[model samples]
Target: MEALRVIVDPPAADGGRRVWVGHETVGLAYCRADVLDFLRRAGLDPERVRLEDAEQIEWHGGGPGSWGARE
Candidate 1:
């Protein structure tokens, strides 16, 4: 199984929050503690951004249900 990465893109239209996939050859998910620690290290506020679970992402549109009509 392939792992997925999640990230925060800050505020924009529609509350400026978007849930999307990211590419990182290093690990599956962005370590939560690491993000928190980074924010602390950078003297930033964790509240400025929100991180969701990205360890196990589900791609629900690639199975038989997605098959096209046969000629």
Candidate 2:
């Protein structure tokens, strides 16, 4: 089974942390409990998904001011 990666992004426009699953925006979570709840609602096992800090991920969008962009 391919490991699912859950990237935690910085707080977005909604003032809540954005969670990403493979370039798809799962949802915005205000806290750890909220994030877990979202995972459960998405039919994903919270324990199985590899949670990653946004800073550690290399931005593939490729543009100025992109998250994780290399200068």
Candidate 3:
């Protein structure tokens, strides 16, 4: 099976962070650890998941972005 595509967006206008699996929004995370934890809890191997940044994906063809950690 294909590894899950995990897209992590920077904080939103409301200051809430987001993660996406395909077009579905899985959940909100405050930091990188939270992102990994959420994925583990959801039965996904965080290591196998592809993490992408929303901003980069929008401008750069969805290339790999930061690992969901707040910079």
In the range 5-64, model 2's lDDT, one tens digit per residue, is: 656666555446666666687886665566777777767876764334444233233211
lDDT per residue for candidate 1 within 10-66, as digits (tens), equals 323332222244542222212344444444444445565343322332222232122
Q: For model 1, state the Cα shift of residue 35 in Å.
A: 1.1
Worst 10 residues of 2 by lDDT: 62-71
Native-structure RMSD, model 3 = 5.6
Better of 1 and 2 by lDDT: 2
Candidate 1 vs 2: which has more TM-score: 2
| Shift of residue 10 alpha carbon in model 1, Å | 20
Question: Which candidate's TM-score is highest?
Answer: 2
In candidate 3, residue 21 scores what lDDT?
A: 61
Ranking by lDDT: 3, 2, 1
Clash count of each predicted structure: 2, 0, 0
Better of 2 and 3 by TM-score: 2
Please list all clashing residue pairs in model 3, or write none if there are none: none
Most accurate candidate by lDDT: 3
Write one digit per residue (lDDT tens) for candidate 3, span 12-68. 555447767657776876655667776777677778644454432231222333323
* Candidate 3 wrong stretches, greater than 4 Å: 47-71
